[model samples]
Target: MKSLGSSCSSRAAAETPEASRERRAGRGALWSAWPRCAPRDLAFCMAALLLFCLGSLFIQLNGGPPKVLLELRNYLGESTYLDDHGPPAPKVLPFPSQVIYNRVGKCGSRTVVLLLRILAERHQFNLVSSDIHNKTRLTKHEQVELMRNISTIPQPFLYTRHVHFLNFTRFRIEQPVYINIIRDPINRFLSNYFFRRFGDWRGEQNHLIRTPRMKDDERYLDINVCILENYPECSNPRLFYIVPYFCGQHPQCREPGVWALERAKQNVLENFLLVGILEELEDVLLLLERLLPHYFSDVLTIYKSPAFWKVGNLTGTVKKSMPTLEALQVLYRRMKYEYEFYNFVRDQFHLVKKKIGLKSLLPISSHEPSFLRELTLHTPDPLEEEEEEVEEVEDDAKNWLVQP
Candidate 1:
């Protein structure tokens, strides 16, 4: 029995050693195989990981956004009004032409600037523009300074400034024709009020004031105190007309009377050369063609092209209304002068059209799609695909005159 037990123990010990050797050999084989295939295996894993991350990012980015496709038939990504290829060389208007562009704000000023700049570039005309954002009222000293500077400007300079009238200190241009652009007063005032209220545009920053101060009487009070008195920027007593500012008078009057309106009308009749009524924009252009016949052979052609506001191309709505209706009404009342002036101007324009027998030449109503109307209203083109549409039109660029 002792001999058999010893033999069994020896046999078990020998089997254990063989089994250990087999296990170690299997592990070694597996480790060696991994190294040989490591490059391809790692590459596959990394590729899969990268693709998964990219897919997640894409889904997150396009998940949610407001879609307003008012009129974007050819909206290839984010295109512009100026054709990438640009227009042909424009016919040149003479230099030294005293142009009083009565720029009405929010009427398509930017487009006008671009058009003027483009035309200047093509025709080698001088272009100079003034920054009205800071100082609406240019002092006599400032005017002198501006004139002195104007003499030094290079040829073909497109000169523009925020001016109420043309009092060029040193300009010696011949038959200097003044140009004024007019729009519906209600629309113009509303646009100006809203743009100042909501958009990031540079103009009057604050909508609320404890008091409104007038521009005329600011000499007696500080800005804070004047606002407390509810004085408007111009210290004139009453809101009567838009032309008072241009006529070298205070925007607000010290006394409320009809004289302010009469004075403004006198200024318009005497000072302005060509008042382009925006209500009769197409007719205005035709008038310009007749007035500047020596320079504008293709007045309609150039006007039909993009000038200001890129009519059909404009997409977004400028912030016009505030949170409360009462606030809006108050602003309208404050700007009542604009409404009065607008009606007066429209009436004058109608009288002129009647006098000249040009009433038949006016563009069709808002519904009509005559080529000229398309240019003035900026009605957008219909989108070919399933997206929103916006109407776009060409502009004669009266808005630039109004903008600061």
Candidate 2:
């Protein structure tokens, strides 16, 4: 039995070693035959998976999520909705950088200009006040040149002149915002009438220097005679002064008729940002401050300053007299167009005042002929003082004693 057991044990050990070797060989063959993944193939598969994730993220960001995804998100307690309305509204326009004040004569422009000088300094804006007061109407070539010059002025500038309306748009130039002031037609006429003769506080000699060619007879002409006798200075075309300032450079603008009147009113509506009345001078300055803070901020404060009043009190036109009631009535009839434009401007101004939450000291009034009669009945005394410098003299030739 011992001999048989030893032989069996030796056989089993040999068999066990052989079986182990066979099993190891089988495992090695199976591993080699199965798909062998190279390092490059594994890296390529990972790169493809990464790129697909990135592309889906890009699509989600730009085109918004897919409808199914959006619905899934909403179902999962996310409250999101798309705006299927039209495209967003256009952006608001930037503020105006260029402003123009083609000022009308004898209408408190001097006062406004004086305030502007101080304002320009205080607010750090460019104020270009034209020295050419005589040439309100310019030729076409001249208009082109002038508009070019004004355009060349630096941005955020305010240019003022005693000039008629210039169509910058017609000249293919950017139009600057416009502003102006006007007074009662008859009042403006009277002020110019006396200002040409005696001038202001500088003395009677001031008129002589301004109107060197005026004879003593014409200089000293009575107001009643000038209007009643149909003198060239007081007649239709000449008395048709203020409208031309608003009616542009068209030749017909100088004519006192419906055409010029309607054109002037249209220009005021389309071009002018504000056309103030001289009677409401304070309100004009306030509006200026509100509308153009960069250019005219604190203008009313400077205008109402004690030092400004001191300078203003020292200046007044000498020997201004109102015409007789009959002469005034005749003048009113002749200036029918002027009064019509004036009334229209006043109404527009009052509307603006109401818009800006401003309380007008001068209430809106009727446009009847009775208004003129009432004006005559309550004709205030001639100006005892004015708010312009003594050295600032308008061209007497343009205002009086010259045919258009």
Q: Top model by lDDT, which number?
A: 2
> Candidate 1 residues 1-404, lDDT tens each?
56988998887677877797998999999998875657889899999999988876876797832244323533546555456657656655464354545364555444445545555555555666655743545666765665567656654344555555544523452323355666654454444444443443332333323124423243233333432355563233333334544454344332334665666667667666556555566677676566644333344566677554354345223554321223323334555555556656666666666677776554333222122333334433456662332221122222221333
Which stretch of 10 consecutive residues in model 1 shows the poorest summed lDDT?
A: 392-401
Best by TM-score: 2
TM-score of 2: 0.69
Q: Write the per-residue lDDT of candidate 2 for residues 154-268, one digit (tens) a residue.
A: 7778999999999999978999899999988888898889988888875658888888899989999988999889999998888999999999999888888899889999999
Error of 1 at 298 (Å): 3.3
Runs in model 2 with CA error above 4 Å? 1-94, 368-404
Give per-model CA RMSD: 25.4, 16.4
Q: Which regions of candidate 1 fall more than 4 Å away from where they truly are?
A: 1-96, 151-158, 166-176, 200-241, 249-259, 293-299, 306-312, 315-317, 321-336, 354-357, 360-404
